[model samples]
Target: MTDTHCTLDICTPDLVKARLAEAADTLRRLPSARLTAKLTAWPDVVQSAATAYGYEAAQTRPAAPSPEAISRMDETLGWLFWIENDGRRLLWARALGVPWRKLEDLDGRSHVTLKKQHDRLLGEIAQRLAGLPAAMH
Candidate 1:
């Protein structure tokens, strides 16, 4: 017998998927030095984003991802820290009903500001999601 407690039925946009793929590819090609920098930097990034977005740290340890889920996420989203610019864009796309690719054309500084907007939006989403019943997870 097998148990699968949850499934994500939502469909992400194609543009969002492509962006995630690119981020993943970039992560894969990073030299060891850059990889180390990312790992060192990511925790602060996640914590800041989570705080800005209002996600309480899991009171208990988070459940480990099943191998299948981990593989699928890596294949789909590259690395899994929650605060990447690409992840923020996907959140914006969901909130604003704009295509993710539109965000890519933005200049670097504008993109950073847009990403901050995305973070705020994601924080709202997190708050709403926290209120939903467990079955909705």
Candidate 2:
């Protein structure tokens, strides 16, 4: 049996928490007018982040939210969550030097995993944005 050792220098849980907190704080300070733009670009930002972190492209096209549905609601939170979760997962995988295939499997097996994280982050960001100036809000 070949003994293979993997050295992982990933950020500690506390560090990750600190980074998330910093991100939330930064988002909170942004003008509300920028919120829509930020939300709209979220998907592409996530895809790029994933690629930057060494996630291989499994599917050329992203999975649609629904097949037969039309006029889907514009859920800004949903968009934010989608971006952050995918990006974070990709980053984590890269930090650990893990195989992209494993990350793809993780993305597939647990649909709600990233969604939950995204929801939490979005809630924080939304709360912050809500406090912005009336014109921007």
| lDDT at position 39, candidate 2 | 86
Residue 14, candidate 1: Cα error in Å is: 23
Please provide, for model 2 over 15-55, each residue's C-alpha lDDT reduced to its tens digit, 9 standing for 90 to 100: 33333443333334444676578887745545477677867
C-alpha positional error of residue 52 in candidate 2 after TM-score superposition, expressed in Å: 47
lDDT of 1 by residue, 1-137 (tens): 12322224432233333334443444444345764678866355454766778786554433444555545445434222445676555553544445445665653445567666665644544444345565543
Q: Candidate 2's C-alpha lDDT? A: 0.42
Best by lDDT: 1
Worst 10 residues of 2 by lDDT: 67-76
lDDT of each: 0.47, 0.42
Q: How far is 35's C-alpha from truth in model 1 (Å)?
A: 30
CA error at residue 73 for candidate 2, angstroms: 13
Cα miss at 46, model 1 (Å)?
47
